[model samples]
Target: MKNILVLCTGNSCRSQIAHGYINHFLKGRNVAVYSAGIETHGINPGAAAIMKEDGISIDHHTSNHVDEYSHINFDYIITVCDHANENCPYIPSKNALRLHHNFYDPSKLEGTEDEKHTAFLKAREEIKAYFKDFVSEYFRG
Candidate 1:
Protein backbone atom coordinates (compact mmCIF):
# COMPACT_ATOMS: atom_id res chain seq x y z
CA MET A 1 0.00 0.00 0.00
CA LYS A 2 1.18 3.46 -0.87
CA ASN A 3 1.21 6.08 1.85
CA ILE A 4 0.29 9.71 1.19
CA LEU A 5 0.90 12.55 3.58
CA VAL A 6 -0.62 16.02 3.37
CA LEU A 7 1.07 18.80 5.31
CA CYS A 8 0.51 22.32 6.57
CA THR A 9 1.82 24.61 9.30
CA GLY A 10 -0.67 23.76 12.01
CA ASN A 11 -2.02 20.38 10.86
CA SER A 12 -5.36 21.72 12.06
CA CYS A 13 -7.20 23.18 9.11
CA ARG A 14 -5.96 22.68 5.59
CA SER A 15 -3.98 19.55 6.22
CA GLN A 16 -6.76 18.03 8.28
CA ILE A 17 -9.22 18.82 5.54
CA ALA A 18 -6.95 17.21 3.02
CA HIS A 19 -6.55 14.12 5.14
CA GLY A 20 -10.30 13.78 5.55
CA TYR A 21 -11.04 14.31 1.90
CA ILE A 22 -8.54 11.76 0.69
CA ASN A 23 -9.43 9.21 3.32
CA HIS A 24 -13.17 9.43 2.67
CA PHE A 25 -13.11 9.62 -1.09
CA LEU A 26 -10.35 7.10 -1.49
CA LYS A 27 -11.54 4.61 1.07
CA GLY A 28 -10.84 0.93 0.32
CA ARG A 29 -8.66 1.99 -2.59
CA ASN A 30 -5.56 0.45 -1.06
CA VAL A 31 -3.87 3.68 -0.08
CA ALA A 32 -2.93 5.11 3.28
CA VAL A 33 -3.68 8.79 3.87
CA TYR A 34 -2.31 10.92 6.68
CA SER A 35 -1.62 14.57 7.58
CA ALA A 36 0.82 16.54 9.73
CA GLY A 37 2.17 19.99 10.52
CA ILE A 38 5.55 21.59 10.82
CA GLU A 39 4.51 22.81 14.24
CA THR A 40 1.29 21.19 15.33
CA HIS A 41 -1.10 22.15 18.13
CA GLY A 42 -4.71 23.17 18.79
CA ILE A 43 -7.07 21.31 16.52
CA ASN A 44 -9.56 23.80 15.12
CA PRO A 45 -13.27 23.44 15.85
CA GLY A 46 -14.28 25.57 12.86
CA ALA A 47 -12.58 23.12 10.59
CA ALA A 48 -14.45 20.25 12.17
CA ALA A 49 -17.83 21.95 11.78
CA ILE A 50 -17.32 22.70 8.11
CA MET A 51 -16.22 19.17 7.39
CA LYS A 52 -19.37 17.85 9.04
CA GLU A 53 -21.37 19.77 6.44
CA ASP A 54 -19.78 17.59 3.78
CA GLY A 55 -20.52 14.48 5.85
CA ILE A 56 -16.82 14.13 6.63
CA SER A 57 -15.92 14.13 10.30
CA ILE A 58 -12.54 15.27 11.55
CA ASP A 59 -13.25 15.53 15.24
CA HIS A 60 -10.92 12.66 16.09
CA HIS A 61 -8.00 14.08 14.21
CA THR A 62 -5.43 15.98 16.19
CA SER A 63 -2.62 18.26 15.12
CA ASN A 64 0.49 16.25 14.36
CA HIS A 65 4.14 17.14 14.20
CA VAL A 66 5.86 16.38 10.93
CA ASP A 67 8.63 14.69 12.89
CA GLU A 68 6.19 12.10 14.17
CA TYR A 69 6.20 10.24 10.87
CA SER A 70 9.67 11.13 9.69
CA HIS A 71 10.81 7.54 9.44
CA ILE A 72 7.97 6.18 7.34
CA ASN A 73 8.15 5.74 3.58
CA PHE A 74 5.61 7.64 1.55
CA ASP A 75 4.56 7.47 -2.05
CA TYR A 76 3.51 11.09 -2.00
CA ILE A 77 4.10 13.86 0.54
CA ILE A 78 2.15 16.95 -0.47
CA THR A 79 2.30 20.32 1.26
CA VAL A 80 -1.11 22.00 1.05
CA CYS A 81 -0.42 25.29 2.84
CA ASP A 82 1.96 27.98 1.64
CA HIS A 83 3.88 28.34 4.87
CA ALA A 84 4.37 24.62 5.20
CA ASN A 85 5.22 24.22 1.55
CA GLU A 86 7.88 26.92 1.75
CA ASN A 87 9.34 25.60 4.97
CA CYS A 88 9.10 21.83 4.27
CA PRO A 89 12.09 20.99 2.17
CA TYR A 90 13.37 17.79 3.66
CA ILE A 91 10.85 14.98 3.88
CA PRO A 92 12.57 11.72 4.87
CA SER A 93 11.33 9.34 2.23
CA LYS A 94 13.74 9.11 -0.68
CA ASN A 95 11.16 7.23 -2.72
CA ALA A 96 8.44 9.75 -2.02
CA LEU A 97 7.05 12.04 -4.68
CA ARG A 98 6.97 15.56 -3.27
CA LEU A 99 4.26 17.96 -4.41
CA HIS A 100 2.81 21.35 -3.46
CA HIS A 101 -0.90 22.14 -3.49
CA ASN A 102 -1.14 25.38 -1.58
CA PHE A 103 -4.29 26.46 0.23
CA TYR A 104 -4.95 29.55 2.32
CA ASP A 105 -5.08 29.46 6.11
CA PRO A 106 -8.76 29.56 6.94
CA SER A 107 -7.95 29.94 10.61
CA LYS A 108 -6.57 33.38 9.84
CA LEU A 109 -9.93 34.68 8.73
CA GLU A 110 -11.10 37.76 10.62
CA GLY A 111 -14.85 38.29 10.86
CA THR A 112 -18.04 37.03 12.50
CA GLU A 113 -18.72 33.42 13.47
CA ASP A 114 -20.56 32.55 10.28
CA GLU A 115 -17.90 34.30 8.27
CA LYS A 116 -15.22 32.27 9.92
CA HIS A 117 -17.26 29.13 9.36
CA THR A 118 -17.70 30.15 5.76
CA ALA A 119 -13.97 30.41 5.40
CA PHE A 120 -13.60 26.95 6.77
CA LEU A 121 -16.29 25.67 4.41
CA LYS A 122 -14.63 27.33 1.46
CA ALA A 123 -11.29 25.75 2.25
CA ARG A 124 -12.91 22.38 2.81
CA GLU A 125 -14.79 22.62 -0.46
CA GLU A 126 -11.65 23.48 -2.36
CA ILE A 127 -9.81 20.61 -0.73
CA LYS A 128 -12.59 18.17 -1.52
CA ALA A 129 -13.29 19.29 -5.08
CA TYR A 130 -9.66 19.50 -6.11
CA PHE A 131 -8.68 16.26 -4.41
CA LYS A 132 -11.63 14.38 -5.78
CA ASP A 133 -10.72 15.51 -9.25
CA PHE A 134 -7.07 14.67 -8.66
CA VAL A 135 -7.71 11.15 -7.39
CA SER A 136 -10.24 10.27 -10.08
CA GLU A 137 -8.03 11.58 -12.81
CA TYR A 138 -4.74 10.18 -11.56
CA PHE A 139 -5.22 7.52 -8.92
CA ARG A 140 -8.52 5.80 -9.60
CA GLY A 141 -9.02 2.66 -11.56
Candidate 2:
Protein backbone atom coordinates (compact mmCIF):
# COMPACT_ATOMS: atom_id res chain seq x y z
CA MET A 1 0.00 0.00 0.00
CA LYS A 2 1.13 3.54 -0.65
CA ASN A 3 1.13 6.11 2.12
CA ILE A 4 0.03 9.68 1.49
CA LEU A 5 0.35 12.73 3.65
CA VAL A 6 -1.77 15.86 3.36
CA LEU A 7 -0.24 18.88 5.06
CA CYS A 8 -1.21 22.43 5.98
CA THR A 9 -0.13 25.32 8.18
CA GLY A 10 -2.45 23.90 10.78
CA ASN A 11 -4.00 20.43 10.65
CA SER A 12 -7.24 22.09 11.76
CA CYS A 13 -9.18 22.69 8.56
CA ARG A 14 -8.21 22.35 4.91
CA SER A 15 -5.73 19.55 5.28
CA GLN A 16 -8.05 17.69 7.59
CA ILE A 17 -10.84 17.94 5.07
CA ALA A 18 -8.59 16.68 2.30
CA HIS A 19 -7.44 13.82 4.42
CA GLY A 20 -11.02 12.78 5.02
CA TYR A 21 -11.98 12.87 1.35
CA ILE A 22 -8.85 11.16 0.11
CA ASN A 23 -9.25 8.35 2.57
CA HIS A 24 -12.95 8.06 1.90
CA PHE A 25 -12.53 7.92 -1.84
CA LEU A 26 -9.58 5.59 -1.73
CA LYS A 27 -11.02 3.13 0.70
CA GLY A 28 -9.92 -0.47 0.09
CA ARG A 29 -7.48 0.80 -2.48
CA ASN A 30 -3.73 0.62 -2.25
CA VAL A 31 -3.43 3.97 -0.50
CA ALA A 32 -3.32 5.08 3.10
CA VAL A 33 -3.93 8.78 3.71
CA TYR A 34 -2.84 10.83 6.69
CA SER A 35 -2.71 14.54 7.42
CA ALA A 36 -0.61 16.82 9.58
CA GLY A 37 0.37 20.43 10.08
CA ILE A 38 3.59 22.39 10.23
CA GLU A 39 2.33 23.07 13.74
CA THR A 40 -0.56 21.34 15.42
CA HIS A 41 -3.56 23.62 15.90
CA GLY A 42 -6.11 21.10 17.07
CA ILE A 43 -8.84 19.75 14.80
CA ASN A 44 -11.21 22.51 13.71
CA PRO A 45 -14.81 21.96 14.74
CA GLY A 46 -15.99 23.57 11.53
CA ALA A 47 -14.06 21.04 9.51
CA ALA A 48 -15.53 18.11 11.37
CA ALA A 49 -19.03 19.51 11.28
CA ILE A 50 -18.94 20.18 7.57
CA MET A 51 -17.58 16.75 6.78
CA LYS A 52 -20.29 15.12 8.84
CA GLU A 53 -22.85 16.86 6.67
CA ASP A 54 -21.32 15.05 3.71
CA GLY A 55 -21.63 11.71 5.54
CA ILE A 56 -17.95 11.48 6.33
CA SER A 57 -16.75 11.44 9.92
CA ILE A 58 -13.39 12.93 10.81
CA ASP A 59 -14.18 13.25 14.48
CA HIS A 60 -11.68 10.56 15.38
CA HIS A 61 -8.80 12.41 13.80
CA THR A 62 -6.50 14.55 15.88
CA SER A 63 -4.33 17.48 14.93
CA ASN A 64 -0.79 16.30 14.39
CA HIS A 65 2.55 17.96 13.78
CA VAL A 66 4.37 16.99 10.58
CA ASP A 67 7.37 16.00 12.63
CA GLU A 68 5.34 13.27 14.24
CA TYR A 69 5.29 11.36 10.97
CA SER A 70 8.96 11.89 10.12
CA HIS A 71 9.58 8.21 10.67
CA ILE A 72 7.11 6.97 8.05
CA ASN A 73 7.89 6.75 4.38
CA PHE A 74 5.31 8.59 2.32
CA ASP A 75 4.53 7.87 -1.33
CA TYR A 76 3.05 11.34 -1.73
CA ILE A 77 3.09 14.53 0.36
CA ILE A 78 0.41 17.04 -0.50
CA THR A 79 0.25 20.55 0.90
CA VAL A 80 -3.26 21.96 1.01
CA CYS A 81 -2.29 25.49 1.93
CA ASP A 82 0.33 27.94 0.67
CA HIS A 83 1.94 28.35 4.04
CA ALA A 84 2.60 24.65 4.29
CA ASN A 85 3.76 24.39 0.72
CA GLU A 86 6.24 27.24 1.18
CA ASN A 87 7.40 26.47 4.68
CA CYS A 88 7.28 22.68 4.67
CA PRO A 89 10.20 21.04 6.35
CA TYR A 90 12.22 18.37 4.65
CA ILE A 91 10.66 14.93 4.96
CA PRO A 92 12.96 12.00 4.25
CA SER A 93 10.78 9.96 1.93
CA LYS A 94 13.00 8.53 -0.77
CA ASN A 95 10.60 8.71 -3.73
CA ALA A 96 7.78 10.81 -2.32
CA LEU A 97 5.98 12.91 -4.91
CA ARG A 98 5.19 16.38 -3.62
CA LEU A 99 2.02 18.19 -4.66
CA HIS A 100 0.35 21.42 -3.58
CA HIS A 101 -3.14 22.93 -3.59
CA ASN A 102 -4.18 26.13 -1.85
CA PHE A 103 -7.48 25.28 -0.24
CA TYR A 104 -9.41 28.02 1.54
CA ASP A 105 -9.26 27.83 5.30
CA PRO A 106 -12.83 28.07 6.51
CA SER A 107 -11.72 28.45 10.09
CA LYS A 108 -10.43 31.88 9.16
CA LEU A 109 -13.84 33.04 8.05
CA GLU A 110 -15.53 35.53 10.39
CA GLY A 111 -19.18 36.69 10.56
CA THR A 112 -22.47 35.15 11.49
CA GLU A 113 -22.84 31.39 12.01
CA ASP A 114 -24.62 31.09 8.65
CA GLU A 115 -21.77 32.80 6.83
CA LYS A 116 -19.25 30.54 8.49
CA HIS A 117 -21.31 27.50 7.51
CA THR A 118 -21.40 28.68 3.92
CA ALA A 119 -17.67 29.17 3.89
CA PHE A 120 -17.08 25.69 5.27
CA LEU A 121 -19.52 24.20 2.77
CA LYS A 122 -17.80 25.88 -0.12
CA ALA A 123 -14.40 24.74 1.00
CA ARG A 124 -15.65 21.22 1.54
CA GLU A 125 -17.12 21.01 -1.95
CA GLU A 126 -13.88 22.24 -3.47
CA ILE A 127 -11.87 19.71 -1.56
CA LYS A 128 -14.25 16.92 -2.52
CA ALA A 129 -14.04 17.73 -6.20
CA TYR A 130 -10.26 18.02 -6.25
CA PHE A 131 -9.52 14.87 -4.34
CA LYS A 132 -12.14 12.92 -6.22
CA ASP A 133 -10.37 13.75 -9.46
CA PHE A 134 -7.02 13.09 -7.89
CA VAL A 135 -8.02 9.60 -6.82
CA SER A 136 -9.61 8.78 -10.16
CA GLU A 137 -6.52 9.84 -12.04
CA TYR A 138 -3.88 8.44 -9.76
CA PHE A 139 -5.32 5.54 -7.81
CA ARG A 140 -8.11 4.14 -9.92
CA GLY A 141 -7.81 0.53 -10.93
Candidate 3:
Protein backbone atom coordinates (compact mmCIF):
# COMPACT_ATOMS: atom_id res chain seq x y z
CA MET A 1 0.00 0.00 0.00
CA LYS A 2 1.21 3.46 -0.82
CA ASN A 3 1.28 6.09 1.92
CA ILE A 4 0.75 9.86 1.52
CA LEU A 5 1.39 12.49 4.13
CA VAL A 6 0.02 16.02 3.94
CA LEU A 7 2.10 18.46 5.97
CA CYS A 8 1.26 21.97 7.10
CA THR A 9 2.36 24.50 9.70
CA GLY A 10 -0.49 23.20 11.80
CA ASN A 11 -2.36 20.03 10.86
CA SER A 12 -5.59 21.95 11.40
CA CYS A 13 -6.86 23.37 8.16
CA ARG A 14 -5.44 22.93 4.71
CA SER A 15 -3.65 19.63 5.27
CA GLN A 16 -6.68 18.18 6.97
CA ILE A 17 -8.87 19.20 4.07
CA ALA A 18 -6.44 17.68 1.60
CA HIS A 19 -6.22 14.51 3.63
CA GLY A 20 -10.00 14.12 3.53
CA TYR A 21 -10.11 14.58 -0.22
CA ILE A 22 -7.21 12.26 -0.98
CA ASN A 23 -8.79 9.57 1.15
CA HIS A 24 -12.16 10.18 -0.48
CA PHE A 25 -10.65 9.95 -3.93
CA LEU A 26 -8.53 6.88 -3.22
CA LYS A 27 -10.90 4.74 -1.23
CA GLY A 28 -10.23 1.01 -1.58
CA ARG A 29 -7.22 1.71 -3.75
CA ASN A 30 -4.58 0.33 -1.40
CA VAL A 31 -3.44 3.75 -0.24
CA ALA A 32 -3.08 5.27 3.19
CA VAL A 33 -3.54 9.05 3.58
CA TYR A 34 -2.09 10.73 6.65
CA SER A 35 -1.66 14.40 7.59
CA ALA A 36 0.60 16.12 10.08
CA GLY A 37 2.15 19.45 11.00
CA ILE A 38 5.47 20.95 11.99
CA GLU A 39 3.62 21.97 15.14
CA THR A 40 0.56 20.26 16.52
CA HIS A 41 -2.52 22.49 16.34
CA GLY A 42 -5.89 20.91 16.97
CA ILE A 43 -8.16 20.23 14.06
CA ASN A 44 -10.03 23.34 12.96
CA PRO A 45 -13.78 23.16 13.38
CA GLY A 46 -14.38 25.36 10.36
CA ALA A 47 -12.35 22.99 8.24
CA ALA A 48 -14.28 19.99 9.48
CA ALA A 49 -17.60 21.77 9.04
CA ILE A 50 -16.82 22.77 5.48
CA MET A 51 -15.81 19.22 4.63
CA LYS A 52 -18.93 17.87 6.29
CA GLU A 53 -20.95 20.08 3.97
CA ASP A 54 -19.43 18.08 1.14
CA GLY A 55 -20.11 14.73 2.82
CA ILE A 56 -16.58 14.18 4.09
CA SER A 57 -15.98 13.83 7.80
CA ILE A 58 -12.60 14.75 9.26
CA ASP A 59 -13.65 15.15 12.83
CA HIS A 60 -11.78 12.06 13.92
CA HIS A 61 -8.44 13.34 12.70
CA THR A 62 -6.07 14.54 15.39
CA SER A 63 -3.47 17.26 15.48
CA ASN A 64 -0.20 15.44 14.79
CA HIS A 65 3.41 16.41 14.93
CA VAL A 66 5.39 15.33 11.89
CA ASP A 67 7.70 13.42 14.22
CA GLU A 68 4.81 11.14 15.09
CA TYR A 69 4.99 9.78 11.56
CA SER A 70 8.74 9.73 11.04
CA HIS A 71 8.75 5.94 11.34
CA ILE A 72 6.38 5.40 8.44
CA ASN A 73 7.83 5.16 4.97
CA PHE A 74 5.83 7.64 2.94
CA ASP A 75 5.34 7.42 -0.80
CA TYR A 76 4.52 11.10 -1.06
CA ILE A 77 5.09 13.99 1.32
CA ILE A 78 2.84 16.94 0.50
CA THR A 79 3.29 20.35 2.11
CA VAL A 80 0.15 22.48 2.10
CA CYS A 81 1.77 25.63 3.38
CA ASP A 82 5.06 27.47 2.92
CA HIS A 83 5.93 27.31 6.59
CA ALA A 84 5.77 23.54 6.77
CA ASN A 85 7.58 23.13 3.48
CA GLU A 86 10.45 25.41 4.45
CA ASN A 87 10.77 24.04 7.97
CA CYS A 88 10.04 20.41 7.27
CA PRO A 89 12.19 17.95 9.12
CA TYR A 90 14.24 15.26 7.44
CA ILE A 91 12.01 12.29 6.84
CA PRO A 92 13.87 9.17 5.82
CA SER A 93 11.78 7.57 3.13
CA LYS A 94 13.11 5.92 0.03
CA ASN A 95 12.34 8.14 -2.96
CA ALA A 96 9.33 9.82 -1.47
CA LEU A 97 8.17 12.50 -3.87
CA ARG A 98 7.93 15.94 -2.25
CA LEU A 99 5.06 18.18 -3.30
CA HIS A 100 4.23 21.70 -2.15
CA HIS A 101 1.31 24.07 -2.44
CA ASN A 102 0.59 27.10 -0.31
CA PHE A 103 -3.10 27.23 0.35
CA TYR A 104 -4.82 30.13 2.07
CA ASP A 105 -5.25 29.60 5.80
CA PRO A 106 -8.92 30.19 6.45
CA SER A 107 -8.39 29.59 10.12
CA LYS A 108 -6.24 32.69 10.25
CA LEU A 109 -8.70 34.90 8.44
CA GLU A 110 -10.21 37.57 10.64
CA GLY A 111 -13.65 38.54 9.48
CA THR A 112 -17.35 38.03 9.89
CA GLU A 113 -18.69 34.51 10.18
CA ASP A 114 -19.86 34.60 6.59
CA GLU A 115 -16.44 35.74 5.40
CA LYS A 116 -14.76 32.97 7.32
CA HIS A 117 -17.13 30.41 5.86
CA THR A 118 -16.48 31.69 2.39
CA ALA A 119 -12.74 31.45 2.90
CA PHE A 120 -13.01 27.89 4.13
CA LEU A 121 -15.20 26.96 1.18
CA LYS A 122 -12.74 28.42 -1.26
CA ALA A 123 -9.80 26.63 0.34
CA ARG A 124 -11.72 23.37 0.34
CA GLU A 125 -12.47 23.62 -3.34
CA GLU A 126 -8.88 24.43 -4.21
CA ILE A 127 -7.54 21.55 -2.13
CA LYS A 128 -10.10 19.17 -3.59
CA ALA A 129 -9.17 20.09 -7.14
CA TYR A 130 -5.44 19.77 -6.51
CA PHE A 131 -5.68 16.38 -4.85
CA LYS A 132 -8.06 15.13 -7.50
CA ASP A 133 -5.45 15.84 -10.11
CA PHE A 134 -2.73 14.48 -7.85
CA VAL A 135 -4.52 11.15 -7.34
CA SER A 136 -5.24 10.83 -11.03
CA GLU A 137 -1.66 11.49 -11.98
CA TYR A 138 0.00 9.25 -9.40
CA PHE A 139 -2.45 6.53 -8.39
CA ARG A 140 -4.53 5.89 -11.46
CA GLY A 141 -4.89 2.19 -10.93
Best by TM-score: 3
Angstrom error of the Cα, residue 50, model 2: value is 0.4
Q: Which candidate ranks first by lDDT, i.e. highest?
A: 3
Q: What is the C-alpha lDDT of each candidate?
A: 0.85, 0.93, 0.94
Clashes of each: 0, 0, 0
State the lDDT of candidate 1 residue by residue for 48-131, as single tens digits.
888888898999997889888988899988899778988985877977888788886789999998889878878888888878
Q: Clashing residue pairs, candidate 1?
A: none
For model 1, the superposed segments whose C-alpha errors exceed 4 Å read: none
> Which is superior by lDDT, 1 or 3?
3
Worst 10 residues of 3 by lDDT: 132-141
The superposed Cα distance between candidate 2 and the true structure at residue 21, in angstroms, equals 0.5
lDDT of 2 by residue, 11-37 (tens): 999999999999899888877788999
Q: What's the CA RMSD for each of the models?
A: 1.2, 0.7, 0.6
Cα-based TM-score, every candidate: 0.94, 0.97, 0.98
Higher-scoring candidate on TM-score, 2 or 3: 3
Mind sharing the TM-score for model 3? Answer: 0.98
Q: For residues 1-141, could you state the per-residue lDDT of candidate 3 as single tens digits?
A: 999999999899999999999999998889898999999889999999999999999999999999999899999999999999999999998999999999989998999999999999999999999999999999876
Runs in model 2 deviating more than 4 A are none
